[model samples]
Target: MAAVTRGSFSVLRQLLSQQYRRRCFRLQNFRSDRTLQPLIFRCDRNLQMFGSRALHTAIVSQGPIVQFKLSDIGEGIMEVTVKEWYVKEGDKVSQFDSICEVQSDKASVTITSRYDGVIKKLYYDVDATALVGKPLVDIETESSSEVIQEEDVVETPAMAREEHTHQEIKGHKTQATPAVRRLAMENNIKLSEVVGTGKDGRILKEDILNYLARQTGAILPPTPFQEIQTPGPAPAPAAAAAATARPVSTPATKPPPTTPKPVFIGKDITEPLKGFSKAMVKTMTAALKIPHFGYCDEVDLSRLVAVRAELRSVAEARGVKLSYMPFFIKAASLGLLQFPILNASVDEGCQNITYKASHNIGLAMDTSQGLLVPNVKNVQLLSVMEIAQELNRLQALGAAGQLGTGELSGGTFTLSNIGSIGGTYTKPVILPPEVAIGALGKIQILPRFDANDQVVRAHIMNVSWSADHRIIDGATMCRFSNLWKEYLENPASMMLDLK
Candidate 1:
């Protein structure tokens, strides 16, 4: 009976195995017919180890290769018309080596290599637009070579090329700050060569200095022109002798009172305004549209002068030189704090007055490019030493004509120091967006009565304030001016509050 029962169980197991095989075969046939939904086999592992490994390998092999996309190239510099190629395919290059000469908007640029590599392929034909950031050529680096597949050709799309071309003509060229481009042009240096030392590697003055130093002996100086002498024809014999004997005397009738003819030339040649000149015109026009009011005041800086000298002595011991600017900046900051409205800007379009919490003071720097105001960001938060350092930096950059767009823009208030130019007093124009500007004049010794009614010589400075009348009333403006004057008269107050 036991043998019979075991035989029945074995038969039942074989029948079950046969049914399972038939089901799998039917599923396969359905999948092959493409008439049934495919089954997704769920993996036992929670994490996809194979996919993770593939991604890790991809990341590792791609290495440091920066495929210049259309964006990497500057705006308005989208498609560069390739003028010349400096290297052939497979040529090895170092960072900053001139790669090609490309023309855009009548100007030509020698684009440089941003990384060290071997040229694998040239993407465009000569005279073609190499859109900014679009790979002009493929670079075969060790790491890139590992990840480079047969299908990974540097493909630039037609739309991308067109976009690059449009950007080159419209945006990039217009957005470049005048100071930076002027420096590049004056030195006959390429903008790409000047590694921006400012925020985000935006080129600054110090970068220009370094570039100039490197290129010093590479460029030849202009040679002076030599004088040329031309021979005159021999004089007629008898007639010339008579003319010479006449003493060439004009009856001193003032030679008929010779009136110079009003010379009318042809059409005057005109160049399209560009760079700082264009920017200045735009800023001034915008500022003039705003309603403005001017207020002038005189401050006795005698006590401040004494305090500055003492502070300078202390600064010298600490290996940092102190300038009058820091004292003035601190004083101005204090005054702004006392009357926050002075640091406010009026949005006439929105009909709103906006008060700023942090004082980002703009310093009007006279650069070769023209008057540029690069702000010292968060001036209120920095110490006097820090302010002096930033002021020095801004001045140095201004002189080198290396200020960036970011530096050139954004300021809650502006300070124009005409004192350096020996000006006693002058009303400065308000920098737009910011409602007010202050001008510092030369400090001079003038006789004035003290609190005790004793007349004595005091070092005094003229303070000129200009504000947008639409934002501030005359009384409020006077109050702001008075606050500044009080701070300058007692600089000790600045030290205490700033500290």
Candidate 2:
């Protein structure tokens, strides 16, 4: 009876196995595609359902460390020179506080802190070249938004405010451009003691010179500016802002900017491309990728010159500096209205043109640094006097290496006024992304026959253009130049079109 029962159990197990195999075969036959491969390997059933236990990754919660990278600092520039550091490692900084100063070949930009936190590390030193989109500085802050909320509710204590005031005193320097500071130092004058006549009580070189002139007959200093030297580490902020403020971990070991290596050419000494010139060369070399053509023409600016002379007193009253550049910028902007395609850029494939809405005309100004083409926004809406003021401001900032990135951005069209330095005609390089660039040559007093066939001395200015041949044809470029000339030559006609 026991043997019979064992046989029956073995038969039932075989039948159950047969049924399972039949179901699997049916399921395989009903499959839609042959893309499903035969299982040559198999994982454990437990692992197939839920992944391997030993392979689990543990999530580690950490506070946020934010990093600020250089981006479009010089309007699509690749790298920048680290000019000066305002904050050092381990120092607490609030949002929007000045962190460091970077010098582009075109201008100097003050980088601000992006977050309120303690600076963990500074990635580069002054005079160092930092690539765009690379790490600059790191700051450690709370990962949660609650910390920011808490900070907003908390008011700074009176003692803390007093301490900050004392620190400012220790810094003991006015916010002046590097040029002004250098002039003051050369005169052995402390900037703190100088009375500022500039905007926001900022000290200018003129202020320092005036103060020194009052003290003595001339602006020259009796003694040179002395340096306070210490053998070891210095803790407090120096009067010149010589060192980075407060080091939490490592104190900043920044050496003074080195003197550029000079090249001796027989009797004269010339320096190689150092700061801004180096940048200009690099950018211009890159701009060679564009297939550009040159256009040359002459414009009679007699009427425009007369108009400027008449407005000279009005400009002086309004505290605006009047120059030929303002007229050129305005005329170019208005001419751009007739030929909007000139104020545009071509697509990468040379397939499309992007017309700009605002006529942000860039003026190429010669500076202590190489030529900088800082643009003025909405040139159409501004009067010539207003444009002159903007030009003056940009030139001043460019000289001091204090021009912001905004001043260097949004340039739809460019004007090169090399005429100021006495050039007759020059095919200026096109500042890329923009299809067209116009250069004004020196205005020559030429004796020419008028419409009445009488010879007269006319203020004739030669203008040269460089336009991308891919987007702008020779005829279109010439027409645009003629339109620009008409605005300057016949100043009366533009009055009816002024919007």
Candidate 2: give the clashing pairs: none
Model 1's TM-score against the true structure? 0.54
Displacement of the residue 32 alpha carbon in candidate 1, Å: 46
lDDT of 1 by residue, 110-143 (tens): 5555456788778777766676646677765554
Model 1: runs farther than 4 Å from truth? 1-93, 96-112, 117-269, 451-455
**lDDT per residue (tens digit) for residues 1-499 in model 2:** 9999999999999999999999999888878545444451355678654654444422123345766555443244678788789999999887546778766665565565546778898999878888866778877764465654543332223222211111111112255676877787688765544545676445677777776664442312211111212122245557336444534332244575699899776786665564567877876885788888998999988888788778866765555556678778888888888899898987667787899998999988776556778898788777665677667666656655445545666799998878767788887888878888988887777889999999998888898999988878999988888888888898887787776
* lDDT of candidates 1 onward, in order: 0.65, 0.69
Cα lDDT for residue 360, model 2?
A: 92
* Highest-lDDT candidate: 2
How many Å off is the CA of 44 in candidate 2? 65
